[model samples]
Target: MEDFLQNLLNGIAAGSIYALIALGYTMVYGVLKLINFAHGDIFMIGSFVGFYAGRYMARHATGEAASLGSAALVLLLAMLVCGIVGYLNERIAYRPLRNAPRIASLITAIGVSFLLEYGGQMVFGPDPKFFPTLVEKKIIHLGTITTTNYQFIVLAVAIVFMGLLQYIIYGTKFGRALRAVSFNFETASLMGIPTDRIISMTFVLGSMLAAVAGILYGLSYPKIDPLMGIMPGLKAFVAAVLGGIGNVPGAVVGGLLIGIIESFVGGSQFSSYRDGIAFVILIVILLFRPSGLFGRYEPEKV
Candidate 1:
């Protein structure tokens, strides 16, 4: 039971990262009906941003606590940088293909993905860089299960960000406009909503979330490379699909489920197949219920 609890905690921590990235995927799909495959690369870029920011702050900080406090600033900078990158991605690569076939946009996204990966390698180098330890690590005992301060911190930050997102999506006027645009682009535009700006906002918001995820992920794993985003990105995509691709709440649920499942698998003898578990779940879910757990099927009008 103690072991089980430990694995569960571990699952939740990892799941928070997956959920964060998945939210980006779901939001973009909700608005554009297009997958920004380069989003994972945006995540990678955010990690590097945090890496440099954290390292620089650590050098100037007076103490461990001060260095840790710098994490908030690091997070803000990463969000701003990646947000701009996402905005540019939409404007330069995705906007032109809006009227074209879906395949064209998909191929363009893939092309962009390659561009970010190789471009990142050229810019940041192919070697893996160690993430600076911004937060001091301490172990906490909860009954029979032991956990770290870092895990709790990661979970807490993720929840805060998710709550803020919920408020933005459901509480604000801009959010109402965003939802309006997502529902029907032409109708929303006719209703005097600036559809283009809303779409750009969607990208900006999603990328910001991804940036936070990237920073949290770096804190957890501590090693990052240009290609690090690929696996996590794919798994997060599975989570999005599992929970109904365009459904916001569903993305969170799916992320937690996938994270818990992965943790359990890792704890067992089949640990070697931990990465493959996502694909298995993806295939199984696709076969049994293609619309996903929370998604209702809609047939095309002939």
Candidate 2:
């Protein structure tokens, strides 16, 4: 039972990160109907940004007194940088292909993914760097289960951001415009909405969420590399699909489910196959419900 509880806690922590990244996927898909494959690379860049920022803070701080504040600042900087990168990615690579065939945009996204990966290797080197410890490590005991402050921090930050997102989507004028554009671009444009600007804003918001996940991931694992986003990105993609690709709340549910499954599998003898579990779930979900768990089925008219 203790082991089960431990695994559950671990699952929630990892799931929170997956949820954050999955939100990025869902948001972009909701708005543009295009999968931004380069999003993972944006996440990688955010981690590197946090890496440098954290290191700089560590160097200048007198002691642990300023660690938490420094970590918050690093998160903000990383998000800002990634948001800009996402904006450029949309403008330079995706915008031109808006009217092109879907295949063209898909291929472009893949090309951009590769470009970022190789470019990152050249700039940051292929070697992995250890993430600076932003907060002192301390274990919290809850009955039979033990967890870390880092886990709590990850969960807290994720909840806060998700709440903010919910408010933005449901309560803001910009969000209404975003939804309008997503529903029908031509109609929205005719209604005086700036379709182009809304699309760019979507990318920026998604990228910022990815950036949050990246920083939280670094804090949890403390080791990062240029290609670090690949597996997590894929898994997060699966989570997005599992929950209903364009559904915001679905992404969160799917991420938690995937993380819990992975954690349970890892705790068992089938640990070696943990990585494959996500794909297996993806396959099962696709087979049973192509529209996804949370997605409503829409019939195509001939």
Candidate 3:
């Protein structure tokens, strides 16, 4: 029982990270009806950026004085850089294929993913680097369960960001435009909604979330690798699909569920295939409920 509880906590901690990334997936899908497969690699890039930035700061800053408030600053810097990268990815790779077949965009997304993974290796080197542990404080403790400061911070940040996102989606003008664009781009354009801009913004927002997830991932594992985004990205996508591809809340639910399932499988079953569990669930969900948990069945208007 104790072990199960401990594992559950760990799963939630990990799931929070997945949920953050999954938001990016759901957002892009909801608006554009296109899966930004490269979003995960963008997450990877964010981790790398933060890892190097921390290392650089550590080397240059004086002893105690230098370390003062550096962690928060590093996180800010990482988020900014990663957000820019994500925005550019949307502008460069996806923008051109907006009117093309969905398959074309999907292929472009895969191409973009490869570009980032390989480009990262060439620039940062293929060797995996260590991300410096910025938030070293550990807080919150139970009988045998404990949460780290970084975990709390990451989870809080994810929740706050998602809350803000929900507000934007359901409350603000931009949100209305976004929803309009999602339901029907042509009508949105006819209504002078600036569909192109909304789509770009959606991609940018999703990318930014992915970047945050990357940083959180680095904090949790403290390792930097070009390929790190692959598994997490894939899993987050599975989560998005599992919860219903275009539903915002579904992404969160799906990510957390995937995280919990992976944790259990890894803890009790073969750890080697922990990553595979997400795909299995994805397949099962698609086989049974193609619309996903929160997805509504939309009949084609033939």
Structure candidate 3, residue pairs in collision: none
What are the RMSDs of all candidates, in order?
1.0, 1.2, 2.1
RMSD of 3: 2.1
Q: Higher TM-score: candidate 1 or 3? A: 1
CA lDDT scores, all candidates in order: 0.93, 0.92, 0.84
TM-score of 1: 0.98
| Predicted model with the maximum lDDT | 1
User: Model 3, 1-302: lDDT tens per residue?
Assistant: 87788678778878988988998999889887788888899889889878888888887775555564676677677678877887787888888887887899899999999999999899989998888866555677777776666767777877887898899899999999998888888999999898878987887788777877887888889878898899999999999998898888999999989998899888885888897899999889989998889999776454
TM-score to true structure, per model: 0.98, 0.97, 0.93
- Clash tally for model 1: 0
List clash counts for every candidate, in order: 0, 0, 0
Q: On residues 1-302, what C-alpha lDDT tens digit does candidate 2 reach at each position?
A: 99999999999999989999999999998888888898888899999999999999999985676888888899999999999999999999999999998789889999999998999999999999999998899999999888999999999999999998988888999989988887788999998998999999999999999999999999999889999999889999999999999889999998888898999999999999999999999999889987788988866444
Judged by lDDT against the true structure, how good is candidate 3?
0.84
